[model samples]
Target: MLSIKTFKPYYVKEEGNYIRVVLAFQYFSLLMDDKVYQFVPLESREIRINRETQAIENKDAVFVFQKGKKYNRITLRDLMCVKDFQDHLSKILSPYMILTQPKEKRDEIDYVIMELEKINLLRLIDLALDEKDQIKFNLYTEKLLEIQ
Candidate 1:
């Protein structure tokens, strides 16, 4: 069975009107068009990291979608319908200027990442409709708050 996991995109690369986001398992691209929404899969994409510039690239990757039932087109409306999609997108796309600086700047990036995760956890707490889940959320929040 195929498993799905939600993750903040590892990195993004822009080419023309297309933007490719490297996820944990694959490279997913989105065409920058207001009228349509779809994620194109770049197969056999080789990731290369430039040591000098600290840049990443997908070498020999074709800018095309895979063909089959599994590659069914996804619409913007469809993505919006998923719970917390907006929150996820907001967190993922936030400016990462802190990451571009030297290693000493990593702490700032780490803090941002932590804050986003905390916000997400709080949102999940709101979505926990059951008493059992609510209790778990309460405990988790208490523990998290203690640390903070």
Candidate 2:
């Protein structure tokens, strides 16, 4: 019988049009016939999911597994055929799929934050100048320069 003992992504990254879920041996492992097999990155450790559809794009992606010196390989397509495996994988990936923001949206948010910071610094600089505080004025100007 095949079962998941542990299944957690090592890290999740946003690529151009996809989300890459990277797995590591220490984080992901499964049980097969009562033996635990650690996942090996092999040629590729990343599983790509489409940003638009939130569907896994690399269903045919192969993963290598090892137990001591013995090695085995399986494609994601085959693994998903098992009901338990599919359900568990879906639960784990659901949050990532739902929470991913578009790159353009993220960039816009970042720009807004930078602008707000600049405005706040300018206000502080003005206050420092009004109070005739030389030290604060210099500090605020340095920060403004760095932001620019």
Candidate 3:
């Protein structure tokens, strides 16, 4: 029987309208006929999935497996027939498929947060000055300097 022993994406990348997932030998393995076979990428380790369709785009991508120096190559499509394999793969890839803000948007959010922190600190510093709290004033000033 064929079964998944380990399946974890080595890294995920967003490419245009697809998510490219790379799998390395160490991250993916299969158990077949009571023997474990580690997946080794022969030419390409990339598995591309359409963002809209969620279907694997590189079904012909080849992977190699070795057993005591004997190597075997198989296409990704061949593994799809294994029971629940697609379901398990979908589950593992789901986390990586969630939409994330682009770098520019993330940077904008960080800038806004920093500005708010600066504004809040300035108000606290003013309050400290009014109350004649030298220790609080010094602390807020130090924090403001660090932020800048």
RMSD of 3: 7.4
Q: Candidate 1: which stretches are off by over 4 Å?
A: 1-101, 129-132
lDDT preference between candidates 1 and 2, better one:
2
The per-prediction tally of clashing pairs is: 0, 0, 0
Cα lDDT for residue 28, candidate 1? 44
What TM-score against the true fold does each predicted structure earn? 0.27, 0.60, 0.61
Location of the lowest summed lDDT over 10 successive residues in candidate 2: 91-100
- Backbone clash tally (model 1): 0
Instruction: Sort the candidates on lDDT, descending order.
Output: 2, 3, 1
lDDT of 1 by residue, 1-148 (tens): 1111243566766444334555543434332232222345434322343433433344434333333333444443444445554555555544421234677588888989889878877776667644558687887688668647
lDDT of each: 0.48, 0.86, 0.84
Which stretches of candidate 3 lie above 4 Å from their native place? 96-148
Using lDDT as the measure, the top candidate is 2
lDDT of 2 by residue, 1-148 (tens): 8888888889888877778888899988889999999999896687788867877888989989999999989888877777777776677667666566889999999999999999999999999999999999999999999999
Candidate 2 structure, TM-score to reference: 0.60
Residue range 1-148, candidate 3, lDDT tens digits: 8777887889888888888888899988888778989888877687889876778899998878766787777788987877666866788678667566789999999999999999999999999999999999999999999999
Q: Name every residue pair that clashes in candidate 2.
A: none
Give the better candidate number (1 or 3) by lDDT: 3
